[model samples]
Target: KMFACEHEGVTPDILVLGKGMTGGYLPLSATITTEEIYGAFLGEYEEFKTFYHGHSYAGNPIACAAARGSLEAFRNNDTLEALKEKVAYFEEELKEFEGLPHVGNVRSKGLMAGIELVVDKESKDPYAPETAVGWKVAEHAMEDEVLLRPLGNVVVLMPPLGIPMDDLKKLVRVTYESIRRATEGKPHNGNP
Candidate 1:
C-alpha cells in the first residue's frame, strides 16, 4: 500500500512524511491535511489566526525537485504495483524466523519488518538492555556483509523498494543465521 493508514481505512487529520520523500537523495518533508482543516486558518486581516511556521530548509527547491523526481519514478515504474510479488515473497521468507526459539514476534508492512527477540518465547521476557542481544545479532549479520539495525531487542529489516529477489532471500538467510548465532545455545539469564 502507498501508506499504512489508507490500508487500514482510517483518515488522519495530519500526515507527516519524510525520509523516503526524496528516496534518500535529499532531505525533504511534507505535511498534508484536509482542505477543510487548511481553510480554517483563513480569515480577515484582523482575525489573528494565521499559522506561522518556519524552518531553515522549509522550501528548498533542490529537495523539492528530488521529491518530484521520486514521485515521477514511482508513477512511471509502477513501484507500488510492482511490490506485490516482492511483498508476498518477503512475507513468505519472514516465516522462517517465526519458529525460532528466541523470536518473540515478527511484524511487517510492505518492505519493512521487525523481528523481536526475547529471552524466552514462552514467557516473552525481554533481555536486559546491557546484554545488547539485538546489537550482537546485527554484528553477526554485518560479518556476512548484511547491515542491520536494532531497536532494543527488535532487529529491524527495511530493504530498498527496488531490491531483487535474490538479495531479499540473502537478507533473510543472513538475518536468520545471525539470530541463531546470537541467541541459540546461550543462556538468557540477563547478564551480557
Candidate 2:
C-alpha cells in the first residue's frame, strides 16, 4: 500500500512514525499532521493554543543522516517494488500456521505477521498469561537462530524488508517448528 491509511482511503488527523523510519539503525521518531492541524498551534501567546511538545532526544544529527540514507536506499534499490514478491511469498508461507492445532489466527500485512495461539481452537480461548506460551515458542525459535517476539499468545514475525528469500523461508520454517514444539508436545497450562 502507498500508505497504511491509504489502504482504507482515509486520512488521519495525525500520524506518528518510528521503528523502521531510520531502518532500525538509530533511535528516532516523527510526528506528521495536516496543515490545518498545524494552524491550530499558530495563534498568539495569549490564546494559549500553542503546542509545546519537545523531548531531549527530539533530534540528533546522526539519526537524521541515518534516516536520510535509509530513505535513499529505499528509493535507490526500489525496495518497495522488490517487496511485493517477498510479501506474497511470506503470505503463502504463513498458511502453514493456520492448520496447526493451537493456532487460532494468522494475520499479516506486508512482511509483518502474527500467529495467535489458543487453548482451544473452537472457543478461541487464550492461554493464561502465566503460561508464557509466546515466550516458549520464541525460546524454541532462538535455538534455531531465529529471533522472534511474542505479544501474549500472539507470536509476531516481522522480517527486515531487505531480508533474503532463503532467510525468510527459514524464519517461517523455524517459527512453525517452534510453535509445534511449544503447543503440541506437552501440557503448558500455567507454565512456560
Please, what is the TM-score per model? 0.90, 0.90
Candidate number with greatest lDDT:
2
CA shift of 137, model 1, Å: 1.1
> Ten-residue segment with the worst summed lDDT in candidate 2?
183-192
State the lDDT of candidate 2 residue by residue for 1-192, as single tens digits. 646777678999998888687899998888889999999888888999988886677798999899999889888989889899999999998998999999999999899998999999899999999999999999988877889999999999989898988898889888888899899984333222
Tell me the spans in candidate 1 whose CA falls farther than 4 Å from its real position. 185-192
* Candidate 2 global CA lDDT score: 0.88
Residue 90 error, candidate 1, Å: 0.7
Misplaced by over 4 Å in model 2 are 43-49, 186-192
Name every residue pair that clashes in candidate 1: none
Across residues 8-80, which tens digit of lDDT does each residue of candidate 1 receive?
9999987889868788888888888889878888898799878675578888999999989988888898988
**Backbone clash count for every predicted candidate, in the order shown:** 0, 0
